[model samples]
Target: MEEQLRELGLEFTKEVREDFVNFRADPLAVVYPRSEEDVIKLVNFAREKKIPIVPWGAGTSLTGAVACKGCILVDMRYMSSILEINEVDWYARVQPGVNLGKLNEELSKRGFFFPPDPASFFLCTVGGAVANSSGGMRGVRYGTFREWVLALRVVLSSGEVIRVGEPLRKNRAGYDLVHLFVGSEGTLGIITEVWLRIIPTPRQRLVALVGYVSSLDSVAGIIIDMRRSGILPEIAEYVDDEVIRALNEHLNAGLRKSGGGILLLRVDEPDSERMREILRRWGVEAEVLNDEEWERMYSLRSQSALALKASAESMYVEDIVVPVSRLVEAVRRLRDLERKYNVRMPVIAHIGDGNLHPNILLERSEDADKIFDEVARLAVELGGSVSGEHGIGIQKAKVMGEQITSHSGKRVLEIMNGIKRLIDPESIMNPGKYVELAYEINRSEERRSSS
Candidate 1:
């Protein structure tokens, strides 16, 4: 297999060891295909050999999505390219390996932008974003990658190049395979290219940092009321007081100097008049800032990992998501975990979408593994998902069982395995991620005995 990969003029390097959420996995081979043809050749070769191939972007995934144990790791970063941008349709065709930040910069020149801005947008690749079906601050309004992706050119495990969806605005298609592959992690197939839906740049923008003297429930109530009144914000976020303080101490920047608990808000529209009225109706007492301040606030919200790393001895973020109505309870339960576990649980949330990144900062004395375990369990108990944005990488694989019911969980596993079998039946693509063939059997047997 390695010889065939090299023969195809693809770069095949020795094994590259990696870890996601502490789930360690090492690949037998790492292949970098410089072009789509290279990808096809490698896929066909792997299929013939019955070897699994895992498609990887920038490897910024917090979930076990990218971690592979003893399989072919196909790094898609080399495939980065902005193939074409259609000004007429306000869409762009890009190779999956293109960086989100880089792509946006190119789009900016043409007066368009992709709305899905994950925290790691600068580092994450578009293909990886699609694989995880990632979402971010703007997700409350724009939703996730699912909404932004218009068309896809994918190479199934069978070495068949299939085009799923199209650049059209609407379609009454049979089955939406585009969406299925979006969040399928790496279990489905390798994504070669993507046609992304782009939006016109907002003409007006406003940001507000609101301080609440009351509990999280009060802040949540404000959001509920705002939603009921039909005020859809472009971006709405929450940062616990503890998290704000940690950021201040970490960056030595006085961000914590302001609010009691903080709600960072950003609104955009072609008309600022409507925005101002909406803000007023929400009864939010916030200090409105211009574009400059708005950019600074966005920097603070998305660049949280830098602050977290600087402030804590060690840290891992818990990206838990629940329904909008369940967000308040989820936050309260997280606070309880903070006290019970004796760890620094600084909470920040995309409140509009009810997704929380409850970052756990740990010291040398604290058991990081135990703390993560408890947090994962809590995510399930609250009617929330184990991961909001980050896919189930190695970090959350163990707790994955808890997220789904036994019957439903087993069914998902079976479908994933079946799809894998149909694609790269040789089991060579992204070996251990999402659905691992070897582990599938073991887990199914375990489920039977437990029942």
Candidate 2:
């Protein structure tokens, strides 16, 4: 396999060592592919040998999605390339490994920008974003990764070059295959290239932070009211006191200590005067923030993840999304959960979309593990999922059965397994990460016997 991969211009080194996970000596070999052809050959070889081929990005994934049990890890960074830019259609065709920050920097010069800005935008690859269907703080208005991705050049498990979807706005074809591959999590195929939809940059913008003394429920209610009043900010985010404290301590920002929570919002328009008036109407007490200050605020959101990781010996990040109407109840419940679990829970969320990231900080103590388990269980009972942006990966695989209650869950698994079988019958591509080979085979057998 190594020789075949190398023959196709790929580079790899085999080492019996622990990758990413230092606590547990996880076994895996990391391989970097140089080109699309190299990825194709590697996939084919993995399929032939039934060896798992896990697609690796920036290793920013908190979930065990990229973690493998002695499988071949294919890193796509080396294949980073922006293949084409279609000015006529306003689309850019790029390799899956393209750095999102770099791509956006280039796009900004062209008077366009990609909207799906993940927290790890600087390091995460487009392939990683597409694979996980990632969304950022701006997702409240911009939507998720699935929204921007128009077309994909993916290599199936069987080493076939198949193009799915088109750059056009509408497509009512037989099936929407492109979306199916969006959040597949490397369980279906390897994405080599993507044709993303870009939009013209906004002329001017205003960002402000609001410190609310009332409960999150009150804030959520106010947000709904504002929305109903036709005040649509480009971004509306919420941060809990713990996260605010961390930011203040981490960055030494002399932020107010009185506010129980913080709401960061941004408005972008051609006329900054109108935007400022709109904000003032919302009682923001608007203070115009400079670019550095705005970035400091945004970085505080991104840095919260790193802070959580650093503060604790071990931690669990929860991506729980609920109905917009239930936003207050959701936030209130999280605070209660923190008290009940006796853990420090820092939250940063896209409140407009009702997506809250309630991160539980835990030390590497035996007592911490028990608390972590209980909190994980409580997260689902509160009408929220275990994961929102960070994928199930291996960390939350056990919790999969909890999310999909009815045949809907079983049906989803079946479909995923069917796609896997159709693409790679030998069960090689990222084996054990998603649906198992037996699961699909059993379903097929049941259908055959029934027929």
TM-score against truth, every candidate: 0.87, 0.86
Instruction: Give the poorly placed runs of model 2, Cα more than 4 Å off.
Output: 1-9, 15-28, 204-209, 212-214, 268-286, 364-386, 407-409, 435-451
Q: Write the per-residue lDDT of candidate 1 for residues 267-340, one digit (tens) a residue.
A: 54432344445445545456766667768778777867667656777778778777677666766777788898
Give the CA lDDT, 0 to 100, for residue 336 in model 1.
87
Off by over 4 Å in 1: 1-4, 15-25, 204-215, 249-252, 258-260, 268-284, 364-370, 406-413, 435-451
Task: Flag clash pairs in model 2.
Answer: 64-394, 65-393
lDDT, candidate 2, equals: 0.71
lDDT tens readout by residue for model 2, 109-212:
88888888888898789999899999997788789898999999889887898999999878787699999889888888899989998888766655554444
lDDT of 2 at 200: 83
lDDT of each: 0.74, 0.71
| Consecutive 10-residue window with the lowest summed lDDT within model 2 | 17-26
